[model samples]
Target chain A: MQATPALTVEHLTKRFGGRVAVDDVSFTVAAGEVFGFLGPNGAGKTTTVRMLGTLISPTSGSAIVAGLPLSPANGVAIRQQIAVMPEAPGLYLRLTVTENLEFFAGLYRIRDRARIPAALEAVGLQGRATDLCGNLSKGLRQRVALARALLNDPAVLFLDEPTSGLDPVASREVHGLIDGLRERGVTVFLTTHRLEEAERLCDRVAILNTTLRTIGRTDDLRDRLFRKRLLVETRAPLTDPGSVFDGSPGVTGWEANGSGVYEIVVTDAKLAAPDVARALVAAGADVLSLAEQRHSLEDVYLELISEDVEATR
Target chain B: MSGERIRAVVQKELRDFRRNRFLVGTMAVLPLVFLVSPMITLLQIPASTPVSVIHHAVGGSSLLLFVVPAVIPPIMAAYSVIGERDQGTLEPFLTTPIEREELLLAKAIAVFLPSVTVAYGIYFAFALTIRFAAAHAVSAAVWHTPQIVAQLVFTPLIATWAVWVGIAMSVRARDVRVAQQLATLASLPAIGITALITFRVVTPSVRLAVALAVVLLVIDIRAWRFVSKLFDRERLITGSRAKPS
Candidate 1:
């Protein structure tokens, strides 16, 4: 049986006057999964997150966040169920880290005061709780925002550019914290422009450009939008690389570049690699290396965004 | 509205305000000067002047008391929403479960308490200076007249009016400086009305105080409603590019 999705957005749209910022975008994020929302600037990624976080009302369509319907009527309940770490850390600079967390705890009406210290500990800021937020580094301020979000123990967490502007070590620390949240079964809706971060952390990703151009498991998208290819390097140039790939069950096409290299399109590179190597050896060619050429998420993202831009133009 | 949420915002704002030395200095210094300067001038009045004229001069001094609440709250409240927006804290704050009413009321109360406290403090201090420093001429009866009634009753109403106006300006203005300037401009009418009473252009009477109080009370209700509407989540989040006319 399929578990009820943590969030389901159906044709969610937002318009600013005559301009439609988010145009009929739809997707679902299952419980405990990290769903990355990737888009360029002006692609309405922040607008969509604002709508889901109940900070702004959608101009049209509907959504269910953590099983609660998205509407002004359910806004308070929905807010209680979800927490958003906005693009800016947005901490109260004058207040201490502990004061900031405690203030939010009061807003969330968290009965147990112990949760403040626990949240601080969870974000690895136990020692800095008494330090003023303005005095902290940018990375530490981001972690303080994260700690504030967790005060509510929200069922769904929306992290927008969570690792943005952080040093490498700080970014890695945040990634590990997000990993811990996943292990604890908290659903995460991550919006980031960082393709590599999405590729590393997201179970599924949606590429949005005002509208959703594509949405699926990252690996599934890589496979569907890109071709799987095998590259072969040999000791000597092959006379007829087409003959070796021809009539092979999994091989779709083949091309021989000058020198000692050939590239072949395959349905599954893992299954077709051995066959291609065997064929080359039988044809009196010494194969030095055979490697699969997998497409990165960045390649898929750029291709989709450019295609959408061209189509719109 | 949840009291807990309102209290939370209020406490946090107060904590933040305490750390803002410039704001604290303005709130403190202005009221002290406004209250004490008049007292010094009134004390220097010649003893040869008629008792009725001294009485009138002391009555006019009560008008300076109105400035305490009027000036302080607008300065503090003007910074309430627009300042938070400039600091980037307003977005995260709006995302919380707290309602709009709770957040605005919290900010209003944060300014209201300090403004009223400082205003009343100056009032009593002014009264003491008259009692001890000018013991020969100015009688306590001057402090017990209709002007005193107006000061006691109408100061908070005007302060509340200033706060609501400041909050309204803060919601509409894009920046803190703009909010402060607009709030100060909006407050001119209240100060003008008080000035009329101070200069004897409009005499203070029980009926007049009650009438002004009633009018200000109605304006307060409307201002509160206007502020509540202006703080719509969509407008605030979008920076209100298309401001309501």
Candidate 2:
């Protein structure tokens, strides 16, 4: 039998007064999956995390987090099964790293003294456990927060903007730690505005702009929102581009983009490439390069957000 | 409800307080400042002074000591929740499994322990000084059984009231300074009642002191429950209340 998903949010909505922060947001994250929640500022990504983390109740709809129904009654049980690290590291600045983790361990009611050191080790901060949190750099503090989240050995970990303000080096350190979490098969629900971070780290990402704009694997989203295409670069422009490409198999249309470059719209790049290439040779054209075009997650995100902006206008 | 969680919060709070220069300075300075007036009042009492004058001086001195527990704790307690919010820690702290009641009680206990300790310590030091260093009549007036009992009984009760008031203000106020100022202002009423006992508006007797202690205890317990309800996680996290489903 398949294992139950780590998170099941159905029509989860949160409104503050007349403003709807998160509207009808629903998605499921499979066990051991690293799911990214991406959005712009005030896009309700944090609010949705707050709801699933049980820090706040939803205005409407429901969710099952870590196998427990999301309700006030199950808040403690659900919290016990999951961990949330907000954007701020939130470590008590005066306490030593070990003291911070020890305090959280006590709250988790974990009798084993081993988890503290283990968590510290997991973040590669074992050597710095004796240092005060205030004395640590921003990167090290973020690691300590990650260690605190790991103390309970939670079933799901929710990280909201885990690397919001860090420099490149610090951000890279955090990215590496997240990659390690993925290796351990931990179910991680990451919320971030950095598109590249989501693209590199998430198995699937959901983009939200108050409501969920789109959600799926990055590749799948690219495929869903953009048509398949091939970019052809040649030594010379086709003397008759339409005659060379009009009857080609799988070739829907073609556009001359630049000097000796043709952007061919295709049903399938694989099926169309051979036919188009053969036709080009017959037309006495010199083909420099031929490859399928690729679109980054950023393209898909911008496309959806621009559509929303236009609709609003 | 978990003791471990409560202990964790209390432990973290105390550790944080110890390092906080403002809190340490407030805890140390307020007791000494409140103590000085009482100590001077008791010390200046000459053996030749009238009985009534000595009684008035000692009663007034004793009343001033109540200010320590009442005023000092509000500053600390008021900082508790709002301080967490100011430092961007409240969200992560609330995300834990600890209940609001446990968090408030632990914060109260953390504030209560030090405030009550300083209040009692100052009172004891004052009483001992009066006993060994002051005039016989003044010392006797200060050492009266009902007075000593009232001091012991009401100090924690008063501190408890101040703690709850501060926490309530912390929960509701948008700014830390505003919360602390309001909490201090709100806590004066607890001391005002004690002042009535000092001035004989409410007679000073063991029976009356005990009865008043009971009343304050009930109010403190009820205040804790009310503050627990006032602690809206949704409001704290989002700066707005969660709409009802």
Candidate 3:
């Protein structure tokens, strides 16, 4: 049996003055799934997060966050069940780390006195609990903010650019903490402009450019956007390569990318790789290597955003 | 309305205010500066002073004391909303389960406690100094029953009014300094009303003072409800209201 979705947004739109921030975008996030919301700057990623997090009301349409309808009357109830970590760490610079988390813990009214220390331990900041947030590095402050978000043990955590400006090591630490949350079966709705972060941590990702351009698993998006191709590299140019490669199983088409490099379009690389190798050997081609060409999430994101750039042009 | 949430806001605000050097400087310096004029005025009164002359001098000094509560709270309360926004903390704060009423009340109580304490402290210190140091006629004039009651009752009410004004300006002003300045300017009217009473322009009486305190109380409560309505999440977040799609 399927549990209820953690978030259900239908025709959710937000406009500021004459500009439309998020335009009629709709999506659902399943329970315990790590969903990534990827978009460029001003693509309404934060606006959507703000709408779902109950920080701002939508201009039109509706949503159900953590099993509660999104309305002014239900705003507090919805907020009680979810946590949103905005792009800014937003910590009180003068307050100690424990004080910051304790304040939020008090807001969440988490009766368990142990949760503050537990949250600090979760973020590896137990020793720095008494240190002022202003004294900590940017990375440490982000961790403290994350600990504050974890105070409620929220059912759905909406993280907006959780690793936006961190160093690679700090980013890795945060990624690990996200992994820990996933292991605990917590549903995470992460919004980021970093495609690699989404690719590494998200179960599914939605690409938005004002409106949602596409939404699917990263590999699925890659497959859906570009055709599968096997890259063949030979030591030297081959004579009569067409005859050698013609009628090969799973080889729909072929083209010479360079003198010794051929790009082969294949229905299935597993089926065509062995046949292509045998044909290349039979044709006396010195084959240096043959491998499937893969596309990264960056390529997919750029493809979608570039399309947006083109449509406006 | 969740006492825990209110307590949390109050705790966080007081903690922040305690550590802020500028706020501490303002809270410390303003009351002391306001106290000096009244202390000097009472010290100058002579034993040979007539009853009416002593009454006028005490009334004028009491007006200066009232300015302590009216002015100091606007400075502190003005920082409550715009300060959080200036530091980028308001968004995370609003995302919590805290209602607007709870936040406003907590902020009011936070400023109210310190402002009223300092105001009352200054008042009591002045009274004690008058009892020991001032001439007999001046000390007796300062200890008038109606005057004592007015100071006791009006300090919190005036501070409460200044707080709501300051918070209202904080909600609307884009910058913290500007909010504080405007809130200070806006709260002067509360002092103006007290000035009329001190100068006997409205013919002071026990019934009149009570009626006016009730009126100030009603305004403070309405101001709370009004400021709560003015606290728009969308406007604060985006600096603009949602336009029709």
Find the candidate with the highest lDDT and give its number: 2
TM-score to native of every candidate shown? 0.95, 0.97, 0.98
Residues B126-188, candidate 2, lDDT per residue (tens digit)? 999989999999989988988889899999999999999999999999999999999999998
TM-score of candidate 1 to 2 decimals? 0.95
Tell me the interface RMSD of model 3, in angstroms: 1.6
lDDT at residue A309 of model 3 (Cα atoms): 97
Clashes by residue pair, model 1: none
Worst 10-residue lDDT window for candidate 3 chain A reads: A1-10
Candidate 1 positional error at A5, Å? 1.3
Candidate with more favorable, higher DockQ: 1 or 3: 3
List, residue by residue over B10-37, the lDDT tens digit for candidate 3. 9998999999999899899989998998
Q: What is the per-residue lDDT of model 2 for residues A187-289, given as tens digits with 9 covering 90 to 100? A: 9999998999999999999999998999999999999999999999999888889998898999999899999999999998888899989998899998999
Of 1 and 2, the candidate ahead on DockQ is 2
Name the DockQ score for candidate 1. Answer: 0.56
The DockQ for candidate 3, computed on C-alphas, is 0.73
DockQ of 2: 0.79
Quantify all predictions' global Cα lDDT against the true fold. 0.86, 0.92, 0.90
